[model samples]
Target: MKIVVAGATGSLGTQVVEAVRAAGHEPVSISRETGVDLISGVGLTEALRGASAIIDASATSSTSTKASIEFFTTVTRNLLAAERAAGVPHHVAISIIGAAKVNANYYAGKAAQEEILRAEPDGWSLLRTTQFHEFARQLVGHGKLGPFQGVPQMRSQPVAATEVAAELVAIASGDPRGIEPELAGPQEEKMSDLVRRYLAATGQRRPVIELSIPGAWGRGMRDGSLLPKAGTRRGRQTFDEWLATQSR
Candidate 1:
């Protein structure tokens, strides 16, 4: 089987590509590096040719609601159009847990992506997962404010990207199951605690300030909307376990 992995160079996409190959499938890499512009449809049709399935892990860094919505809508539209043209059978999408429940800009985009997938006339599957263990490190970088590092007051069960990748490959190889079971980490952890642990492991001495972001998005994060529901699949690696493997 041949699988087309959009955003193949991304954090999750890279693992998805390797997992597809490990499962005895050829993974066609699609990214700017691979000459595939998903939003513009450039190189996309050629990449999808002869492909059995497409795993869309593509993403953007924009935090603006309008920009995020436009980016996802365009990317998903192009991918689906190419898939339709190529006669591709399955389209597997990775989305964040509680995307529909939150009012954040990024989550709005994700929700739009899922909605588009749902309306596709072809076979598609949506896998919603919680935050990755890497979120802690991302917070460390984004939360910096002079000498004090800000940690949002939220709760999350952060799964490993590798684990999520493996599950995505398995889905792409099998029949499409619309809205599959959610995936989460082994246990829940506070956002501030995760950041603190990450900083400590890296020998950073900056003061960690816990902040309460205002709005529905913030409420959802602090009120357990981001946590996985019961019976959801849980990843094996805990935050501490994953943190131990990171380079100092």
Candidate 2:
């Protein structure tokens, strides 16, 4: 199987690409570094040519509402169109769990991506997974004041990125299962607690203060609206297990 991996250089993307190769498939690395920009549709057709499946792990760090929505929407549409034209059989997209429920700007972008993919005529599988364990680091670094880091008051089942990538590859290599089971970690945890544990393990002394996000999105996050419902498949690793690996 020939697999086209968008965002091939990212943390999760890198793992997906490696997993694909390890599964005895050819992985075409697609990203700006490889002259393929899904946002602008640059080199997309060529990159997807002769590919049997596409795993979209692309992402941006932008927080601006307009930019985030635009980026995800445009990239998703471009990828779907290209996959259709290229006669790709399976299109697998990774989305955050509770994207629609959260209603945050970033989650809004992901919701848009999901909508676009779901509407595609080609076979598509959208796997919505909970936050990665590394999200603890993202929370601490996404915003920083002079003396404190802003951590949202939220609950999550943070899975390992490698585990997420493994599932993605399994989906890509097999038949497309539309809107498959939601994936989550083994245990529920608070964002603040995970960050505190991560900091302690890393020997960093940054004070983390929880703030109530001032929107429906924030409320949803803090209220556990984004958690995976019962019957969802759970990953084996816990946040603590993922954190422990960092010290190794």
Q: Please report the candidate that would top lDDT against the real structure.
A: 1
Error of 1 at 107 (Å): 0.7
lDDT of 2 by residue, 1-248 (tens): 99999999987899899999888999999989999888788799998999989999999898656777898999888888898899898989999888876656788888778888777665999888999988888777675767887788998988888989889989988888888788998889999889888888988888888988878778878888878898889999888878878972
Each prediction's RMSD over C-alphas, in Å, is 1.5, 1.6
Clashes of each: 0, 0
Model 2 worst lDDT window (10 residues) = 138-147
What residue runs in model 2 are displaced by over 4 Å at the alpha carbon?
none
Residue-level lDDT tens digits of model 1 in 1-248:
99999999988999899999899999999999999998888888989999999999889978677888898989988887888899998999999999888947778888888889888665899999999998889789788999999988989999999899999999999988899989999999999999999999989998899999888767888899999988888999999998999888
TM-score of 2: 0.94
- For each candidate, give its TM-score against the true structure: 0.94, 0.94
